[model samples]
Target: MSQRRQLPMPRPRELLTNSSHFFAFGFGSGFAPKAPGTVGTLVAIPVYWLIADWSLPLYALWLVVTFALGVYWCERSSKALGLHDHPGIVWDEMVGYWLTMLLAPPGWQWMLAGFVLFRLFDIAKPWPVSLADRKIHGGLGIMIDDILAAVYAWLAMQLLAYFFVG
Candidate 1:
């Protein structure tokens, strides 16, 4: 048991397997019993701080790669958990929130807006987003809807920027 406890955590791998199961999961933020999506979105704030210094292109590239890979990991982990889109697999939210922030002004206002828009779009699931959420299942299903939500949030943020930001 000591050995098991001491074992290193898995790292996020782009391959079909080997993901930073816990870290990629926002330190288990996805495991919330209720409002898992809400928890997932909330956990993304600090991630933004950590990656704030990186170039936008790099951050975008990393998010894209992670989302693409998360399709499988999320599905597999969900399956393993005997649940579909378990809250514990919140890597999807992390990537999506990052996507939303990429378009923002990178300050308190933008962070606040990104948080609100991402959560709203994620929960509202308008148009094809709703369709995708209901029709799709498994990893891609979990990841895609959030991706769409992020896109919507990003657009909304851009609109706000146009109207509100200088």
Candidate 2:
């Protein structure tokens, strides 16, 4: 019988030399000692603020560009880290958080709610999100589940806004 091969763990030194590391780590947010995904998502808040005033089409363009870049670098980082869906690779979290906030109303309250909801659905991984997490591989594998989680969060945020803010 053939044995399954194991991927090697990513090293801190790779962060110094690898461009992918810069993104995969969410510009170092992934280096946090605990809850790196949460930290990465937090880091995305300022980025969201920067684009909040942009036209909807422009904002969407940026999202598409960043998501494409994320797909490439995240894949490279995964290969470098040698671990599929490594905890430290948090670009997905950053992108996912942005997606969660894309249609949310402007306010600290909405932002906080988006953050909490995104984190909840991301960690909980219900339905299609869980399915993608388990079945997909490579860059798409890393990003899809978070995207699904973002979708769930976005829907919840919209409902909350309808009832509470609208």
Which number leads on lDDT? Answer: 2
- Candidate 2 local lDDT, 1-166, one digit each (tens): 2121233435567777787888878888887767889999999998898887788898889878878888888899888767787787899998898889887899888888989999999999999999999999988898889999999998998899899877
Candidate 2: residue 56 lDDT (0-100): 82
For model 1, the stretches where C-alpha displacement exceeds 4 angstroms are 1-24
Q: Please write out the lDDT profile of model 1 over residues 77-154, one tens digit for every residue.
A: 666556676556778887888889885776877888898999999888998899988899988898999899999999
TM agreement with the true structure for every prediction: 0.81, 0.90
- Each model's Cα RMSD: 6.7, 4.4
- In TM-score terms, which candidate is top? 2
What lDDT does each candidate get?
A: 0.76, 0.85
Model 2 weakest lDDT span, ten residues long: 1-10
Q: Residue pairs in steric clash, candidate 1?
A: 11-20, 12-20, 30-87, 30-88
- lDDT computed for candidate 1: 0.76
